[model samples]
Target: MFLRRAVYYWQLIAALLLPLWLFVGWGIWGGGAWTFVGVVVAAPVLFIAILVVTLIIYGRSEVRAANAVSWLDVALLALWHLSIIGLGCFGATGSLFAMLTVVTGLAAFWGTLWQLVRGFTRRARQTLREFEQLAGQTPPRGHVSSPEQGDVYVVYESRDQRRA
Candidate 1:
C-alpha cells in the first residue's frame, strides 16, 4: 500500500524529471550525435507518454479514491520508469532497454485502459442490479401518493369593475 501510493505520486514527478534526465544523461554519458537527435524527440514523447498513462490510471474511480494504484500498475510502471532511465544512460545495452521501455509503456497504457473499461462496466452492472432489487420492492402499506395538481389562478377586480 505504501509503495503503491508512492509510485502513484512518483509517476507525476517522473513525467517532468525523466525528460530532463534524458537530456542531462545524453550530455554526461556522451551518446552518439544521432542519439542526441533521438533524445530530442524522445524527451517530449516520454513526457507525453508518461502523462497519458498516468491520467489513464487516474481515470479509474477506485484508484482516485484510494489514492493508490494496483500491484499490476506498480509492476508495469516501475519497469517502464527503469527502462526509460536505462535508455537515458546510453550504455551498451541502451537499445535493449529502449525496446523494453516501449513494450512496457504500451503494456501500461493498454493495461490501464482495460482496467478503466472493466471498472466502468462492473460498476454499471452493480448499479443495474441494485435498481432491479429496488424494482422488486413494494411501497409501504399505508403510504399514498397525491394525484397531480393543475395550475391555480386568483383574480382581483379594479375599482371600476366594482362600481359597475
Candidate 2:
C-alpha cells in the first residue's frame, strides 16, 4: 500500500522533472549553433506530442484504470515545460527578461514542492483515519465477546487452542 502511494507521488515528480532535466541539459551543453537550434525546435514539438499522447491515453475508458494521470499532472507538465522554454529564451539576456525567467522558474519549483507536500499531508491524514477506524474495530487481545450472551469473556486457553 505504501509503495502504491509512493508510485503516485513519483509520477508527479517525474512530470516536474522531465522539463527541468531538458532545460538544465540544454543550458549546460547547448554551445553549438545547431544544437541550440535543434533544442529550440524539438523541445516544443516533443512537449506537444507528449501532451497529446497523455491526453489520449487518459481519455480512454479502458486505459483509465492503469493510467492514473490527473489534471494535476497535465498542469504540472505545461507549467514546467513553459518555464523551461521561457528560461531558455530569457536566460541569455542579462536584463529584466532574465529576472522574469528566474522568477518563473522559482515559482514553478515552489508550486511543485507545495503540491508534493500537500499530497503527502493528505495521504498521511487518510492513513491515520483508516488506522483509527481499524483500531476501533479490533477487540482486546485474549478477550472475546458473544452478541447473544451480551457478556465479555476472557479466554485463558493456550495460543494454539485460540487459533483452532
Candidate 3:
C-alpha cells in the first residue's frame, strides 16, 4: 500500500520535474554554455505554466484522487525520461540510437497528452449526463403546471421501465 501510494505521487512529481531535469541535464552534458543558461532560465517558466494548466484542469481534489496515476503513466514517464537522458549521453550526435531516443520521447509525450485529453472528454461527458438528468427532473419555471384530474400518467413502472 505504501509503495503504491509512493509510486502514485511520484508520477505527478515526475510529470512536473522530468522536463526540467532532461533539459538541464542535456545542456550540461552537451557542454554548451548558452544551452545550459537557456534551459536554466526556461525551466521555471515552463514549470509554472504547466503547474497552472494542471491546477486549472484537474483541480485539487481530482489531482489528489487515489490511484489517479496508473502503471501506464509510470511506464511512459520512464520511457521518455530515460530516452532523454540517453539522448544527452549520446551528445546530440546524429545516429540511429539518437533517432530512436527522439522517437521514444515523442511517443511518450503524445501518449501522455492523448490520455489527458481522453480523460477530460470522459469527465465532460459524465458531467453533461448528470446535468441532463437534473434538468429532466425539474420543469421550466414559467411553464410549470400541476397534474390535472384528466391527465394520463403511468400508474406503475418496472425497474427497467419495459412493459411485460
Candidate 4:
C-alpha cells in the first residue's frame, strides 16, 4: 500500500517538478544570462541538498519509519518554488510568466500541504500505538458478574414452626 501510493504521487510530483524546472529554465533563458546561471546552479544544488537530507533520514531505520520534520522544512521547500515563481513574475516582464508563477506556486503549496498533513497523521498514529503499548494490561476489575460468586436464592421459613 505504501509503495502503491508512493508511485501514484511520484507521477504527480514528476509532473509538477518537470514543468517547474522548465519554467525556471524558460525564465532564465528569457530574463538574462545571470538568471540562467542562477537557475542552472541553484536548481541542482537545491536538489542535491534535498536528496542528501532524504538519504540521511531514510538511511536510518528508526528515523525512517517515524519521520518528523519541522514546518520550516516544509516552508523552505515551498519557498524554493515560490522564489522561482517570484523570479518569473517580477523578471519576466510579461503576464504569461506571472500567471505561470502563480499557478505553479499554488500547486506546489497544495502538494506540500498534502504531504505535511499525511506526515502528521502518520506520526499521530505511531504515537498512539506507542502510548497503547506503554499503557500495559487492562484493569482486573469489571462490571460483569462472575458465575462463581454463588447463586441468588430466597430463603423462606415457616413463621408458625417452633425453633428447630
**Which candidate ranks first by TM-score, i.e. highest?**
1
| Per-candidate TM-score against the hidden true structure | 0.83, 0.41, 0.50, 0.33
lDDT of 4 by residue, 1-164 (tens): 44333432343353346346645556555656665565566455545544443443334333344444334434444454455445544344545554554455455445545555666788789999998987764333333435696544445556765664
How many times do residue backbones clash in model 1?
0
| Residue pairs whose backbone atoms clash in candidate 2 | none
> Could you give candidate 2's per-residue lDDT for residues 96-158 as a string of tens digits?
533553465455445545555666687789999999999998788866678885777765754
Give me the displacement of residue 47 in model 3, in angstroms.
Answer: 9.3
Relative to the true structure, how large is the alpha-carbon lDDT of every model?
0.90, 0.53, 0.56, 0.50
lDDT of 3 by residue, 33-150 (tens): 6656655764565455444433332442343576454455556545654654554453645245446655665565566566667777888999999999999986554453556634
Worst 10 residues of 2 by lDDT: 54-63
Candidate ranking under TM-score, highest first, comes to 1, 3, 2, 4
Sorted on lDDT, highest at the top, how do the candidates line up? 1, 3, 2, 4
Backbone clashes in model 4, listed as residue pairs? none
Scored by lDDT, model 1 comes in at 0.90
- Superior by TM-score: candidate 2 or candidate 3: 3
Cα lDDT tens digits, model 1, 1-164, are 99999987898999999999999999999978899999998899999999999999999999999999999899999989999999889899988989999999999999989999999999999999999899777455554445464433435555776667
- Alpha-carbon shift of residue 42 in model 4 (angstroms): 2.1
Considering only N, C-alpha and C atoms within 3 Å, which residue pairs clash in candidate 3? none
